[model samples]
Target: MWRFLSPQILFGADSTEYLERFEKRRAVIVTDEVIKNLDYVSDVSKHLENSETVTIRAREPCIDDALELAEEMREIEPEVIIALGGGSVIDVAKAGRILMEAEIEPEEITPFTSLEEYGFRGKTSLIAIPTTSGTGSEATWAIVLKNIKERRKVIMAHERAMPEIAIVDPAFVYSMPDHLVISGGFDALSHAVEAFLSSFSNPFSDSLALNSLRLILDNFIMSYGGDRDAREKMHISATMAGIAFSNSQVGVVHALAHAAGALLGIPHGLAVGAFLNPVLEFYAERGVERLGEMNRNLGLNILREIERIEAELRLFEYIPVSEIESHRSEIAERAMEDSCIVTGPFVPEREDLETVIERVVRRCMREES
Candidate 1:
């Protein structure tokens, strides 16, 4: 059976106001200290003044604090859960909520269990307001976290974890620094590319993935260069890509990033971008037919299909990165086990991952230096 999941999205300025309408006696705001300072958090708190609000200080979501937050929720008795930060905070919210509702260990919250059977009382509303328009956390059913004990990243994904509401306000986008803009664009790029080439991708998701990919390619550079119009398009595309990949799932780039992040705490965008081009070429063999279909939709010549996409997305970067080698072995092993790896048309084995890491390391260093 096929599943399609999406939150009821609220996009544009002041969408954070939806928090006030939350029908609950008490609420918990799961987020980081950084986001708490933003206007988004202040506005959400202001709106929900009638409802008791508690904040979980999850700086990076997957840290050891999640378990404590999970336990705290039981005492807080929050009827509603609102995620008001980036991917990290959103993930912590998901884990904490699931832990409370399921009354299970954090690691046991997997696809096999039926969470709805746990019977959360009331609407148990989940509202996600993304300060950054990437990771598709506002739109997707994916949850990523670092299992600090096991020293690995875990994904607790299910259709129901999809937020009841997704607030994608452009006003928040203006608050981003230049590094965040560049990094966020890369995250969205990986989502579009991985989903577009996913083995499980069907006609429905292919259309969304392709359109989002085009939008990112057309807008990322311009948006990063400070064009509001371009930034707006990219903001919209980030949600679109989230919806697409949520249906089809991401591939190698994500697999590598997940592994690298859990082990070395490398930033998601940089880790994903470091290996994107190599995996793109590797997946190209299985990706060509699907990519050709996208080219057909764009009315482009098939001969230069992926070439056009490369130019449009500026997909290749030969950065002379020296740090990747430090954790190379561990990263290789973890990437091999990532669930997203199997979804690639050409799934790389351990040897292949190692080889790709080597090439990416050498190439990125050359490009950056």
Candidate 2:
């Protein structure tokens, strides 16, 4: 048996206006300082009759940060939570909302764990409004938090962790920075690619994955060039990729990205960008038939397309490749323990991961030279 899951999505122009439907209901806007400074919070708050805004300090929240937000939520006990920022803010709200309603440890949240068993009854509704066109945190059940003490990312998920709604309005992302545009595009691209290659991929996920991949591949460069039409396509594609991967899975690219982000303080999207091509190349060399199948089905060399995108956007220049090289073995070891590692089309050995990391380093070196 298989299951496909997704939040009810409100997409396109003025989708944020959907929040006004909950007029007079008590609402909390969970966001970050950066987003709060922007008009996004006020824009969202203006729709509700009664609402409070909470800003998370960390760009990437830690366990304690999520727990603290949960404690605050418990105090306010708002009827609805509006996650109004990028993936980090949305993830915190996802984790915080469940932590508020249920009495359980953060690690207890998993695909197999029954949230209902822990007294979670969805007393508080979650609505995610993504400011950026990446991470697809608004649509997925997954939550990623940092374990500061251990220097690893805590990947958590429960069916209930998914938001009740995802508002994908292009208005918010129209003014997004060029760097974010590049990073987020790559992140969405990786999601679609990894979902298609996942061991758990099914027909439902495959359709979304392929569609998202095509859209992202076609529009990423144009999106980065500040084309509103391309940006809108990217925003929609990111959510589709999120739902695709949520129902299926991400593979070695994500596993390695997660490890590097946690240990090296790299942004998740940037890390995903850095590792994507190298890992895909690794899969191709190992004769992962799915890569060839995807290429044939799309009638395009996906790797060649990725290489073009990377070069066009100077994707590798942002990463600290030498630092990553120094910690390559450690990153590989940590990645092997990630939950995403096993869900890849084929499980890789430590040596395979090392080889991929070496590829990333060498590629970056060549780019620099």
lDDT of 1 by residue, 112-214 (tens): 7677667543346678877776788888877887777776888777766678888887777875876667667878877887787788887777878878877
Worst 10 residues of 1 by lDDT: 311-320
Local distance difference test values of all predictions, in order: 0.73, 0.92
Candidate 1 deviates by what RMSD?
3.2
* TM-score winner: 2
The best candidate in terms of lDDT: 2
Worst 10 residues of 2 by lDDT: 57-66
